[model samples]
Target: MKTLDFWFDTVSPYAYLAFERLPQALEGISYSVRYRPLLFGALLKHWGQLGPAEFEPKRAWTLRQVHWQARELGVELALPAQHPFNPLALQRLALACGDVDGLPNRRVVEALFHHVWRGGGADASDPARLQALQAELRPALDPQGGEVKQRLRALTEEAIALGLFGVPTIAFEGKLFWGLDALPMLRAAMLGDAWFDGPWNEVARPQPGVRRR
Candidate 1:
């Protein structure tokens, strides 16, 4: 069986969508997923890029796209009251739910995603709501503890080292399939499709003829 590292940030609508669609996307594949929570803002910073929500026009388009995608995928998704809110607390909470390996269980990950996506335009960072979620989780570790904070940081650093620049990335067989749209390709890769043997590797070798300033 293959192990898929599902790297995500709770702040990403695409991540929530991907999480909801993942099971159906890989129905017959023999693989286990490790839920990894990381800071998406940190990733954007590292890549010297702005998040989709950081730009006005892009933010509008992104919101529309994600909502359309949710409906198409038959998943429930509501944009939070705010876009690109700090996800540090959510990341820490997820790490606090980890057992020895610092990887949260699927249940914990799912609960977090639902908390952010299911509430109808709710404030994801609201203290009262977070308190209720904490009570519900009853995590074995303290979400506010230094250990959990350090773990979150370490995971983000590790993600950067692995060349990950975005959330909802699935790392399998040493290759990364990024975003919700990439799920079909991911499924194809898992099935050992012959196209990956040549075209996949060949596609990356093309040299750019022009440079943007």
Candidate 2:
């Protein structure tokens, strides 16, 4: 079976969006999804960029687009109290959950995304918050916090070694599909379904009821 390398940081709005939609979106498929948890700062360091809000126009545009998608997805998203919540523990906890045998990693990841993105909760850094999240997610994960945290450190190091740059990245075979907008293309690639082949903006005037993707 084909596997998708699902990389995401909790702070990313797009990642937040994908977390809510991925499972059902890929139902009936033959692919396994693996979560690759990493720190956003590590990747941003490569581009010499700080957080998004500091970037003005880009942040403004992104907020607008994210809000639009949030409304479309019907998920409540408040402006986070701060940007770039410390992701170390969060990633570690996820790694622990991922390591659990027969545990639902995707479901827990979805819950983490919802908690972080929907409630403006700071999860990546807060152990209590992370503990609460794990409890609400799965009993098996809730009991393995220490081991999970230890494994998270290892995963972070692994992410650095993998040359990971960002979150919400979907990798299949050896190719990486970045962002939620790429989900359709990733789905297509897996199913041998090609919706677009040539120019993307060919339809200057689209039908009234038709939605792209």
Candidate 3:
């Protein structure tokens, strides 16, 4: 059986959208889904890319699109009061919870998604709320847990190495499909379809010696 790496960041609205539908979308499929918790902030920093919230216009448009897409998909979604809350603890908690290839980790994913996106509290970043979550999940997650933090960092670095620049990316058999919009394409690739056999377009190859300007 093949395994697909699902790289996600808890604070990402798009990730939340994918989280809601991924299971059903993947139903009857032969792939094993492994939920990997990674830091989107770190990726942005590494690539020197601006986050959606850092640019006001894109942020507004993206949020609107998110709502529309959620409704179109019939998935319940709500934006947190804070757009880019700290994701360190969330990632760590996920690591502490163990593998999400099964039921227990699924619940943790849903609960964290709800806590940050659907719930109006926007308290997932609050230390008190984090403690409450840690207590409730009973996952042996210490907010200051060292090993879990390292694990999360390692996963984020692994994502970078895998050529990932965003959340909700699915990596299967060395092929990467990014964003919820790419899910269908990913499914096709997973099913051994011919759509993936040829080049879709041509672009310039990266010149490492030349500076990007």
- Give the alpha-carbon lDDT of every model: 0.92, 0.68, 0.79
lDDT of 1 by residue, 28-135 (tens): 988899999899999999988999999999999999999998999899888999998988888899999897787899999999999899978899999999999999
Q: Is candidate 2 or candidate 3 better by TM-score?
A: 3
Which regions of candidate 3 are displaced past 4 Å?
99-104, 200-212
Q: How does model 2 score by TM-score?
A: 0.71
Instruction: Give the worst 10-residue stretch by lDDT in candidate 3.
Output: 198-207
Error of 2 at 174 (Å): 0.7
Worst 10 residues of 1 by lDDT: 97-106
The full ranking of all candidates by lDDT, starting with the best, is: 1, 3, 2
For all predicted structures, in order, the TM-scores are 0.96, 0.71, 0.88
TM-score of 3: 0.88
Model 3 lDDT per residue over 46-129, tens place: 999988877889989988998899999998777777777788887778778875432226688888888787776466688787
Highest TM-score against the true fold, candidate: 1
Give me the displacement of residue 131 in model 3, in angstroms.
2.0
Best by lDDT: 1
Over the stretch 90-193, how does candidate 2's per-residue lDDT look in tens digits? 56556656644422377777776766776664444466766677666554453346766555556556666666666778777665677878777777777865
The candidate with the higher lDDT, 1 or 3, is 1
Instruction: Quantify how close model 2 is to the true structure by its C-alpha RMSD in Å.
Output: 8.3
Cα shift from native, residue 87, model 1 (Å): 0.8
